[model samples]
Target chain A: MKFDAQWIAFITILRKEVRRFTRIWVQTLLPPAITMALYFVIFGTLIGSRIGTMGGFSYMEFVVPGLIMMSVLTNSYSNVVSSFYGAKFQGSVDEVLVSPTPNYIILLGYVLGGVTRGLIVGTIVTLLSLFFTDLQVHNVAITVAIVVLTAMVFALAGFINAVYANSFDDISIVPTFILTPLTYLGGVFYSISLLPEFWQGVSQLNPVLYMVNVFRYGMLGVSDVDVGFAFAGVIVCIVALFSYSLYLLESGKRLRN
Target chain B: MAHALLINNLHKVYGNGFEALKGISLQVEAGDFFALLGPNGAGKSTAIGVICSLVKKTSGQVKIFGIDIDKDFSAAKCELGIVPQEFNFNQFEKVRDILLVQAGYYGLPRSLAEERADKYLKQLGLWDKRDTPARMLSGGMKRRLMIARALVHEPRLLILDEPTAGVDIELRRSMWSFLRDINAAGTTIILTTHYLEEAESLCRNIAIIDSGKIVKNTSVDSLLKTLNLETFVLDLREPLEVSPTIENFSLRLIDSQHLEVDVTKGQLLSDVFSRLLQEGVEVLSMRNKTNRLEELFVSLTGSGAGENDEI
Candidate 1:
């Protein structure tokens, strides 16, 4: 496709993907906001007050960043998997396959849709966090950068999951058995520094741990892991997953034939 | 270069190691109505799949409007539109949205997309259902929706894989005229159908494939010319208690009021009338036992030409 056509094509798919999730606002947009609000009441107000302060901040302030990050990660991953797989199951993917649209545009369009949803839900959860405690942006540049980067990383992962998924069940398997556990153990509720030395070493290997801490460092100005390492690790993951997703689109494994 | 579509030595082998198409080649002239006829598993859809880029080709070259798919697939694809055998659109989308969204895929701006979407929807007689969800459409309407979607881009080449399957007679004829008008206006069309009568009445040129091979490829007239015999059902003027034996013509008494007559090619119908008059059996009216093209298809595809083939 020509440059202009490619841009239009990307925008079309991106708009369609956004419309799909937005149209189902009750299921897509509202659920995360409501769930996170509940977390603030239960975990932040009730239990957090009893736990007192941690990491030089009130417990409510500390867990707020982690809850926002968790919302971003889960929403980003779920958006792409469900939307892309819905397209595949209905064979509507062939609509784009037969068009002049290039492979990368298709990948980017879906990824951006995922990222948009992630960020929207993340922002909602963050606003809900404010009602629980007074929160401040420790670093404006780092906050925006980490939030966008975190959304992109998980959105790419969702794209890969959708590509390999042969069934609706396949799309959910990773989130149910793997992603949920990673987010919980990724220092979302507590800093890895609070763990034993052996488990902290193990937590270093969990990719989600880096994302949560980096985002926490952006919001709280303190991180259990090195700041540079967190950013570098997530960047490498985004690049690697994006490349693999592009390869799958070009290969057309379960898509074309 | 004069052809709208050209396939040279095309082949396809599924991952299961089953070869669906074996070195088949074809050329469809611009503004011509062509038919790719085959029985179940004859690879007609596979061939269309390869052309539309839905199914990856194992090996060969395909060009649309002289642009080779491999070298300039974007240009080639822009010139092409395909409606597959099955309904593949989003069932939840409004009918109008389906067509409008399809126009966007080809880079049409919102204004032009709405214009083309309105044009095709009205043409396909789906205007009343424009706001209706696609899932609410009947089977025939869904089929028409696919056709409308394909034409929204105004592709130079249009491929319909059984576009009229299961449509009622009225809607089917309307679709036929719609296709004819577009073809007359210079859009090249390639159709695949189980209904031989549809192909015989609509297509100008034809190709018959079976078992991963092209059995015949020629003009429709030329293919019909190969028929050695034709069976006609004659409505008798009067009932007969005893069937009369006729010389030099194969005859069977279907009932007292009907007779099945098989006439060899190059034989005139007047001869049969003349003989029937001499036998004191006045002729009323007659029609071919089956469509002429159907006879040829059955003869070419062997026992695989299932009269009710869903494919």
Candidate 2:
């Protein structure tokens, strides 16, 4: 009920979450950084050299924003899904649930934790990419806005996943079966314009494609997808996921019982 | 005094049509140490769940401190604190942190939360482990930490679900004393424990639930009086086989040299001694089994002995 007190709960959960991942930084923070570096090396360097250009920009430059977005999305989603599910699995979520904290406060506390991890991993990957190719941001506002919004959207998605997950494997199933496939097909390395007209239209439906193109537009001032549509798509996903996650918490589906 | 917790016609039927609670109703008075005793699968946990809003009730209403849980859940919950049976604190956090965070959840400022955290952690004898991660503490310590966390908000009613289960005798005794102190200070305590002796010692009012219904609900003294079963044990100086005529004493062999029997209040012990002597069974020393609550619990639940008596 008190704003100051609710903020304290939010900060407490956020601190615990940050400490949880940082305590095992080798597992939580380092893996994504290493994976992103590998992507920059293998796809950005080796493949980009052979492919020439994408959307009027050098392939390496074009892929930089997409790869960063990929890291943000995966790290943000996994940070919340794994942490929240781990709490449930360990039977520690009862500590939070039994407390007087409102459902929305708990939801935001976890979302912020996810966003923090996303931003940290994104920063690390950005610095890693600099070792291979110089990058520039055409619009700093759009760049920061897209990264934060994408992280927020995915973090909410992860919260929903944690709500329904009965086991640890359930948390990873979405990433393996759905997330990986969508990311690989979401224009991380090549422009959607290169695909056939039918495929181009089909790719528009993949939410990750919209995110990747939006980030690309921010960094290189070029995108195969319409920039205005990309921004609208990200905003809509954020609002939708946020409302759905809050509804799930309020209903206590798979959570209270 | 107003009731601290009131449940009216509560029902919970699982998805498979297994009714855990069947229109059960009960009231716990303010400042009363009420014990809810039942066998496993008898809906003890389900009742607690419904009261805490963790499990949905198929029908009925729950009021805490005169506030309807359905219409004013936050206000109702503000008056209650639940110490679950499971150790459910964030194990990665320190003992002090867990308590402080719990206080914050109740809308307490940081300074007030810290003060209450320190107060409870010290009172629960967890001050020394304040900096230790919860996961690293012993089971007893963890259980105490949960109690501390629950009490941080100073709710009017506290619900403890098996608070002493799996704890050592020393810790359990200390916990009982702590609870007694809290109850004396006017916090209504509702406890569910497998230990009948705990209820006998701490609770004045008791409810015996079986198959989701209140089979027996009465004052502890009245319940014990209704049983009228007194246990007497005689230790014999010499081992002897009792004569068949000694059956008049209604004795059973507790061991080769010992005889045990349950006698009503008006029954005479002298008659039993004379009958045993007539049968050539030597009696050296006699004593009464003082754990009357255990005996009553066994009788009411229709369970033969103490082995499976834990609820």
Candidate 3:
């Protein structure tokens, strides 16, 4: 395909994905917003009141950035996993498979669609957080870069998950058994400094810790890990995930007979 | 004239150690209406799957409009359109959106995509249901929507796998007319249908594949000519207690008023009628016991061309 045509095809797939989620807002968009609202009400407002301070800020203030990062990563991941898996289950992915659209265009389109949803939901959670606590931006550049990069990383991971998924249950296994546990344990609720030295070292092994801390650094000027290391680690994750997703598409693994 | 599709030594061995297409080779000239007939598990769908890149080929070469598939698959894909045997569109999408999105996948701009979507949707009698979600449409309507979606890109070659399967007769005839119109407008068509009469009525060339091989590849008229034996069922005006004796004709009494007669080469229907009349039997009406192409298909494949061929 020519460059111009490839661009059009990319846009087409992206639009189809965006429409797929937006058309079912109650299922895709509303649930995350409502769930985040509950978290803020119960965890940040109710529980954080007893906690004096965290990382030199009010407990609610410290937790807001972590919550927003959590939403971004999870929404980005789930959007691609469910949308692509649904397309596969319905055999609707054949529409693109039979077309002249290149595999890279297909990959880029779905990843961007995931990123779009993730950012939109992240913004919604951020706006919701403002009602409970004041959110002061420590660094605008770092804040934008980390969230976008984090969403892209998770979206790519979701794309790979969708490719290997053969059934509806397969799509949910990663999020339930893996993603949920990682997000909760990845410094979303507390600073690693509170942990014993050995546990703090173990927390460093969790990728989500770097993401959450870097995003917290961007938002609150405080982080449990080095900001530079987090940025480098997230970039490496993006490259590795993106390459693997592209490789899967090129190989037609599980997508073609 | 250039061939619209060319397959040479194409082979496909599925993951389960089953060979679907065993080095089969065929060609369809541009603008010709072609029929690909096969029995259950006869590798017709597998061949189409390989051509459309849905199933990987174990070996061989395929070209669409003279563009080699292996050399430039995307370019070759641009020259072809496929309406698969199943309904593969998104059920929740509106009729028009499906067409528009398909057009876009071929790299058409939004304006052109919309124009073609409108054109094909209106042409296929789907304009009224353009805003309706696909799942709400009837079976026939959904089939028409798939045809519209395939044509939205205006491909030079169109391959339809059982386009009218399970469709009502009225709807089937309409789809045949539409397919004929597109072929008339210079689009090469390759169709597969369980309805033998459908192939006889629409296709100029016919191919019968069985057991992963092409048993017969010839023009429809030529294949029909090879059918030396023809059976006709006759309805008699009066009940007959005994079968009629006719030389050079095999006759059996299906019932008191119905007779099954087999006429071979050099036998005439007029002669049968005259001999039966002399025997004091008056025929009310008569029809062929089975389609001529169907008989030939049965003879070639050693299987009845009946319904429920999943492969």
C-alpha TM-score for every candidate: 0.97, 0.92, 0.97
Positional deviation of residue B154's Cα in model 1 after best superposition, in angstroms: 0.9
Model 3 ranges with Cα > 4 A deviation: B303-311
Candidate 3, residues B1-311, lDDT tens digits: the string is: 55899999988998899998888889999999999998988999999988999888999999999988899999999988999889999999999999989998999999999999999988999999999999999999999999998899999999999999889999999999999999999999999989999999999998889888888888999988888889999999999999999998899999999999999987788999999999999999999998898888887888654323212
Better of 2 and 3 by lDDT: 3
Worst 10 residues of 2 chain A by lDDT: A91-100
Model 1 sits at a Cα RMSD from the real structure of 2.8
- Model 2 lDDT per residue over A15-40, tens place: 87788888889998899888888888
Tell me how far the alpha carbon of residue B136 in candidate 3 is from the true structure, in angstroms, after superposition.
0.8
lDDT of 3 at A199: 91
lDDT of 3 by residue, A1-257 (tens): 99999999999999998998899989888998999999999889898888879888888998899999999999999999998988898888999999999998999999999999999999999999989988899999999999999999999999999999988899899999999988998999999999999999999999999999999999989999999999999999999998999888877789888
Tens digit per residue, CA lDDT, model 1, A1-257:
67877788788888888888888989999999999999899988999999998899888899999999999989999999998888899998889889988889989999999999999999888888878889888887888888888899889999889888999999999999999999999998998888999999999899988888878888889888888988898899889999999998889878888
Model 2 stretches with alpha carbons more than 4 Å out: B236-249, B252-256, B268-290, B303-311
Q: For model 3, which pairs clash?
A: none
What DockQ do you compute for every candidate structure? 0.78, 0.53, 0.89
Interface RMSD of each: 1.0, 1.8, 0.6
Q: Candidate 1: which stretches are off by over 4 Å?
A: B303-311
